[model samples]
Target: MLEVDGLTCRFGAKTAVDNASFSVQPGCFVGVIGRSGAGKSTLLRMINRLEKPTGGRILFEGVDVTALQGRDLRRWRARSAMIFQQFNLVGRLDVLTNVLMGRLAGVPQWRSLIQLWPQDDRAIAISALEQFDMMPMAAQRADQLSGGQQQRVAIARALVQQPDIILADEPIASLDPRNTRIVMDALLRINKHFGITVICNLHSLDLARTYCDRLIGMSAGRIVFDGVPAALTDTIARELYDLEAGEVMDETPDFVTGTLAPAFGTAAVA
Candidate 1:
């Protein structure tokens, strides 16, 4: 459903992403992992057309995203939604209103700015909130909720758009273990149940392994490893992260526990 070819991005002299190429099928869930400054987030942004690529092409259902502009770009962008690490909610807006904003692309700005959403839009927003079990909090201000609740609200907002593809960047970075699980589980549920193509930039290897069907590892603005999580070896991981044999863990999440085994060997580290 999504195709990226020879994608490259640069900021003046620095290349943030280079020659990145990948394809995601419908209902596929993919995770991207890389160290800070490895360009994982850049890749996602480029895919969504939020960050224009210096070269290469991005095609969504046969349309060239790079060539889109004006109304076409706006409409195409509406088909894909993004979730951030920080819940980017209007602190003062009610939860329902926040979700309703997802429909802004389809609604007139005058109508949206005046908080005069159409009845159908309102209904869709409410249903999305219900999907996330945030309906009870619909009347509450965004600031009134906890971090996890806010994130779920953000997800509801995305769902309100009925996006074909979901792009999440470091979505679990700011949450605790429980919240992380909650957010990740919600994303997985949406992908599995609704068949929304999901591409996320993740920091937690365990979460990536447990939830994503495929993994792409990046280093120095280039893709280094792309395969199944179970196939990842200590040597490959070390090379991806630039760590020594025993310096990286194999079993534990977040490099907190587990020992590294011989290259490609099934040695559990705890």
Candidate 2:
């Protein structure tokens, strides 16, 4: 459903993403793991066309997203939504309105300014909230909700767009452990139930291992490891994080930290 080839991005003289290449099939859950400044976030932005790549081609359903312009670019962006580390909701707006904003792509600018959404659009927004069990908070202001609630609302907003692919950059970074689990659960549910392709940049290896079907490890703006979660090893972790094997063991999950285990078995990576 999504293809990235020879993706490269530069800031001044330094490259943020160097010739990264990967493809995600429909309904797959892919995780991107690396330390700070590994260019994971940059890669996500480039996939969504928010950051123009200096070299490479990004194709969504066979359309070259990097070459898109004007309305075409806007359309592509609407088809593939991005959720940020921060919830990025309007603090003062009611939760329903925030979700309704996701329909802006289909609504006229004048109607949106006056907080007017079509009846069908309103129905879609409400249904999206219901999907995440966030309907009760629809009338409340965004700032009044907890971190988890805000993130769910953000997910609902993305769902309202009916996007084909979801790009989440550290969606659980600011939450506590319980909230992190909640957010991850919601994302997983969305991917499974809706069959939407999901690509996320995560800081927590445990979370990534537990939730992602495939993992991609990056270092110094390049992809160093790409494979199934069961194939990840202490050596690979050390290479990805630039740590010693012992240090990697300390960071790996207790069950599978020492040896490779069957997929989704008791001996799991974290």
What TM-score, computed on C-alpha atoms, does each candidate reach? 0.90, 0.90
> Model 1 over residues 1-270: C-alpha lDDT tens digits?
798999999999999999999888899889998777899999998888899999999998899999999998887777889998888999999999999988989898899878989998888887777767798999999999999999999998887777899999998888887788778888887787678889999866667777899999999899989898998776687777775324324435533212322221111100
Off by more than 4 A, model 2: 243-270
Off by over 4 Å in 1: 243-270
Who wins the lDDT comparison? 2
Would you list the C-alpha lDDT of every candidate in the order shown? Answer: 0.83, 0.84
How high a TM-score does candidate 2 get?
A: 0.90
